[model samples]
Target: MVYAPIHESLPGPISPSDRIESIDALRGVALLGVLAINLVTEFRVSIFQHFLPAALPASSLDRAVETVLMLAVDMKAFALFSLLFGVGLAIQFEHLAANSRRALLLFRRLLVLLIFGLIHLCLIWNGDILTAYAIAGLVVLPFLFGPRWLLLAGAAAFLGLYLTMQVWSPPGLFPSLASIQSNVEEANRVYATGNFGEVLAFRLREIALILPLHIYVFPRTLGLFLLGAFVWRSGVLQKPNHVLLFTAGAGCVGLGAAMILLRAGNAMAGTSFGVLATPAGTILLALGYGAIIIAIASSARGNALLGWAAPLGRMAFTNYLAQSVIFGWIFYGYGLGLFGHLGAAEALAIGLVVYVAQVIFSGWWLGRHRYGPVEWLWRTLMYGTPQPLLRAGLNDSGQRAA
Candidate 1:
């Protein structure tokens, strides 16, 4: 849910002073789920094999963890992340002067994001979303100039189209289970034991194979982006009831599960119903989580309670990339090579540890610096100048000495 700004405008980067702490807190909260789900993908198992019969955990503990993740985290985290990406664009638009050239600035910003995404996708992580987001962001650029209703309608229409495709179960749109299984087998072997060059080559090959999937998921990601923008303009998120929204989200989750069960025991059901159901629940729960966090951030007392999360959210871009780097070291072949070794339970535990450390570090870093390291770099490149990186007591480029 979004609301009208209580403040004025800026051009390049959003200053720490201009931020809505509630949204920061929401991003922080969303990152936790995101990390959990990513860990499962990165450390425990490949998402390509998610529909395989072998995906069911062998142990009760891992099974329980998988169950919780399925209902709560999986698609929900990515959905929230995508929604926030859209929200950030809308906020940037609002911050511009009335006569501002929105397209050029947004283009530069997304170009930087696309570069970051490509590096992440090709050299660092195979499951990168930044490129997909930058691509979708580019597609939504023209809509920024449209009226509020158009944003909402585009969101609904795109999402409806995506859902229809899922339910329709178009042949060959989904990769065969055998093909996916072969890829997963090779991925596990390469990521767990191959050297740097070997892993890099394998990732390149995998990216080419998954290119079609990128197209398939675009509508869902774009719809969420548009929905986020609409809410920001309409102020629909300004005062939503947290409990009610969360309850509704939980119902959606249950509804999605029921949809999958309708075709349960069918081979590779994820290729069919699982894909159809997962995203519906994801969008709703993401909204619910956002509303809950916003409500907390709105109150003086509640804001104080969730204050720690604000810094975490503010540094989300940095932390997001950092997770890939750190976890790659822990799980990939060139480092600890623990890939495909941990159970769902252990991966979840490690994810929690990583998130806590990020929370603590983000608070400490933001106390002294104006932006996270990556964010500072992003702004510098986007605006074609060095942005300030320190506070009143520190002298830096773009700042006067205290």
Candidate 2:
């Protein structure tokens, strides 16, 4: 099946329209990848140090499993998600431009995203990227009308400055040794002895202060977004031929393998190159993911996996929130209290279980319902009208009356 942006292009071709199949498929794959990487972070466990590596020890068997997962699933998924977010912005901008209402509409959307992000951060988790993305998006807005070369140069400059900051620091920006130790000690205390409120409070303080990382990290995200826009313009998603699909698969495998090797080296040498390398690797792997999706779309093949994946992609915001809720129950003191207790492999196993359940649940829910719950709510807020929740032959906006 073909995928298109939710909103139609105004000035662009009206016949075929923009079918962004590659993005949908990529999004589905990325959602799963998100669970792969985020489960550890959300549970407050170090996937490498405390989970996978510790769980494995000297066993070649465990090492084998760890190697496969690290290469195939870790770190890359979130980058893909971020890139897609930028693509969504580009699509929205395209529509706004078509209607000559970009300034107000875009600002409204970003404000809403920031509000949603704040709620998620304060109530659910401190690692929310929504506000950061909204803020960065605003910074990138003026440059959106610039030429491709300028955009590329700007992205590169931003990335270079960010890398420099990582290795060296301005005075007073670096945390004091006492402060660093206190933060680490506090984290350990929360994990070891504190309750949910204490853990939330500790993390909230750190998150509130890390604005620079969000700003400087812009180059890569903006770069990827531009790449996505280029791809959208180039008809890659529409074509989905063997060459594109094959290239993507190979790319995913190659970059994914390299990242795994780098991670292993980082572990051996007590280095952090892996963290720095992850974004680039994620970009490559996202391409690979795109290829995989294109292959599925082009072949006209259907599977339970894709069927399930489609629903999650269709209702990504809801599913994202659902992940937090489900994982919170699995890991937090409010539920099973398995935080810091589960290893990476076991965590992945549980994630898979939850994924399967979500797939069935989402598929069933969509079959009978009009939109995923949150999607309906977001649309209602956007249009300032109460949208119907059930299907009744109305427009896609759910405005048809009984």
Off by over 4 Å in 2: 1-21, 44-69, 146-185, 188-196, 208-216, 248-256, 259-263, 266-279, 302-305, 393-402
lDDT of every model, 2 decimals: 0.80, 0.62
Candidate 2: the clashing residue pairs are 3-20
Task: Judging by lDDT against the true structure, name the best candidate.
Answer: 1
RMSD of every prediction: 5.2, 5.6
Candidate 1 per-residue C-alpha lDDT over 128-191 given as tens digits, one digit per residue, 9 for 90 to 100 = 8899999999998779889999999999998998888777745777677788889999988998
Please count the clashing residue pairs in each candidate, in the order shown. Answer: 1, 1
Q: What's the residue-level lDDT of 264 in candidate 1?
A: 41
Name every residue pair that clashes in candidate 1: 1-237
lDDT of 1: 0.80
Report how far off residue 402 is in candidate 1 (Å). 7.5
